[model samples]
Target chain A: MADIKSPVPGTFYTQATPDAPVYKAQGDTVTVGDVIGLVEVMKTFIEIKSDMAGTFAGYAVENEAAVSAGQTLAQLDG
Target chain B: MAERSAIKRLFIANRGEIAVRIIRAAQGLGIHTIQAYSEADAEMLAVRMADEAICVGPAQAAKSYLNIEALVQAARDRDADAVHPGYGFLAENAGFVRAIEAAGMRFVGPSADTIDRMGDKVSAREAAQAAGVPVVPGSKGRIETLEMALAAADEIGYPVMIKASAGGGGKGIRVAKNADDLAQMAPQAQAEAKAAFGDGGLYLERAIQSPRHIEVQILGDGTDAVHCFERECSMQRRRQKVWEEAGAVCLDEGIRDKLCASAVALAKAANYVGAGTLEYLYDSAANEFFFIEMNTRIQVEHPVTEMITGLDLVQEMIRVSGGEKLRFTQDQIVRDGHAIEVRINAEDPILQFMPFPGQVGSMRLPEGDGIRFDHFLYEGYQIPPFYDSLLGKLVVHADTRAEAIVKLAKALDELSIDGLKTTAPLHRALAADISVLTDSFHTQWLEPWLEAGNLTATP
Candidate 1:
């Protein structure tokens, strides 16, 4: 299965907010439109979505970890 | 950013020739230098010359130079006392400047407030107007609707220029000679401006015909300022300046005095610091000058001014940021000799200036008493497509304009970078042209000249 990648260079976060539940955990199922993480750059936040409909392998980066463009934020397996 | 006066080690947040320029300037002042490099630039001259070099990120500018948080962290990790953004990337970014300051590191350029004011074209026009600097007639506020632009056109008159409020380097600019042209070009200009500069707000300005793009160089210490003559940057292609010369010709002495004085006045009004440039459109027919914008940091053509003034602007910027006042007063500064700068890019002028980025098989630069070549390319070096196509800059100074042109021709002949096409031939050809020599060239000169086989003239 393909992976969800960061569309831009920025800090990555698994959840939308501090109090919100994580979007995905290990072995969780995901769809094409599922928001796996958020990539923030220059104060603009963009949602990183999975392309493959499969089981989520959790985030490669932790909260506030810097990520580059095209960096794989999460892996998926059918 | 860190407080002033504590700077011992400066982390240069850029790459290529500008990065090397900053590092050398810092080393000359006995300040320890740190260079931030992308993976592609790990072996560049700037990285090798610095006291220490660290890989900030990969090749793409967004991953490297434009990564503000990464740059700040790199500075913090290295314990860098200050950060010097040498044009491009985050040089004029007010938010980046603020972030650098907030990280307890100094940004060795203009204050964040000044950057915020001048970074935007609309506000810069207001600042210039408030300082009594002549400004092109334009809308004082953002035009939210096409009707608003139409109203502004009626008041400012037709043949107006539609520009993005946050534009630079000729992007987001559309000249509508009539109402029909305005109706078609306005929205396209706005969309491009929004994509390029992140500001879609449109404004209108009276488009001055045959205007010479002249700019005054100024150095300020937040309290005092001085002018360093002017640069004629009319030789441009697609709004990107290709060739520049010091001390514009045909500019009356009275108009020169007024332009220089107005530039200083604008700087003082902003409490501007470090090296800055005030651009203007000199309408020779009307004998009037209109302020365009103020570049908040060192300019690409800064070497031409440096060649004529014998001033190390980069060093002066660092010193001034460290609390050093203006070293030379108005009278103390003297203009000497003539200088010209040509941007050598890896592109084909015969084709539509498309970037020819690739490996540099062999490279040899000119060396002489008054020839200065600023570049990062070398034998085996790869010119990446991820950044600007500026391969190098060739600058020469001589006793007079004619002599400087001759020296430039020689310097261009002596310089060679193999396996990659460069604009050297274009500079050589342009230098030999009598029109360019006689200072009759305009902003629209290059493309037509190239199209007409004029730039292919043998040197």
Candidate 2:
């Protein structure tokens, strides 16, 4: 299993916006460089993209939760 | 007339450096200080410095700093005598002012009606015109149709700005060069405005080419007003002022007098209370200035004015809010020397100004004469990522603009904040630039300088 970690310390969101759908779902296919979520830091949004292709397992952190840099956000099954 | 009583308790309804600024002013006045913070900001410097601190809500500003009900309730419960909405969040929000006043606490700003009137672009333009202040010639009011925009563009001449009536922060604005451009761009601007602000109302203004961004600072006691000179904030990126200077060297003494007088006139016309700023777009070639809008709160660049004028604006504003009269006449307020303030934001300037929120480590601040640093940072403090990236302001003053630039460079070299990237290097480069040294730049100058990799190249 490969884990997707946040690149910055901020609040992580599963969707592009408050009213948008989740960028990915459980058991969905993940490709390299595919956007998985967003991390908002200091009022600027940075996209969190998948580095390795895999099957999306589940989000390890709750949506809109404060996260530290290098903290695992989602689990992916290789 | 009622007897004036000094505020016994002052509650700060904002965070970061400005909060610490208000707290210091309140403490100096022997007022009990109360600071409000979100869960993310509990460990901030202001929280530690205030006499008392309260957690308002969650990390998100919408649930905390921007929440009018939470802030008002907190202030009332604390038995606060006054609330200081420093600069942002609810500083300009009329509803917050009304709620604070309704709670029997002084809001420390202008009345709600004044905020509402000055907050709208069209209404503010009308107010400026009525006060005999020059404004950018364009539509008298909102242009409702494409045909109306076309006609207004024709009258205003070429290169007119089509802006949303409800827009701010450089959004919902499009510049049309000619008639065809106006016809094509107006519809798109209208549609974007409708989608963004839920109001597609648009206005037009003659776009001044490479205008200097100058603003006048004025303080009023509801009955009288006085101008505290002007600040030039033309060095901006993404419409955010990166560096600011007081007593803009670009204006001659004659034009400066007229500009400051017009600002005071507007304040008197509005019967303005507390501290406010009248923003203008100045055309250096024509020696003309047009009032654009009014910010009815203390600004971030206020220190430059204070540094040059030797007046504590925060303390003065609070005194006026407590039913005090203007302390000094316009003649008493003297501008000496030149002051410059550079914003030290938590961003990597080399990386296109990307936000960098990290824990503050060993910090070394510049000290001595003519140098001031206003910030809310402490060793080992973790900067919360949910807010703006402005870490602090490094202000310097000297006998002349040239000397101020020299002082800025020296102070920038002395200042250091470990464990986080900052925009200090950007200021270092700007201070050494020839155009900046000669004061021969405009509002559109900084972006091109950055785009040309000036920040990356060593001076």
TM-score for the A-chain in each candidate structure: 0.92, 0.97
lDDT tens digits by residue: candidate 2, B1-459: 344436889999999999999999988878899999999999999999999999999998989999999999999889998999999799999999999989999988899999999999979989999999999988867888999998888888778999998898678678898998998999999999999999988989888989999999999999999999999999999889999999899999999999999999999999999999999999887788999999999999999999999999999999999988988999999999999999999999998889999999999999989999999999999988899999999999999999999999999999999989999999999989999999999999999999998889965
Best by DockQ: 2
Query: Which residue pairs in candidate 2 collide?
Result: none
Query: DockQ (Cα-based) per candidate?
Result: 0.04, 0.87
RMSD of each: 8.6, 3.6
- Top-scoring candidate (lDDT): 2
lDDT of 2 by residue, A1-78 (tens): 999999888889999988999999999999999999999998899999999999999899989998999999999999
The residue-by-residue lDDT of candidate 1 on A1-78, one tens digit each, is 667787656568789987999999999989888888876543346688777799987677787776766788888888
Worst 10 residues of 2 chain A by lDDT: A2-11
> What CAPRI class is candidate 2?
high
Q: TM-score for all predictions?
A: 0.76, 0.91
Each model's fnat?
0.00, 0.92
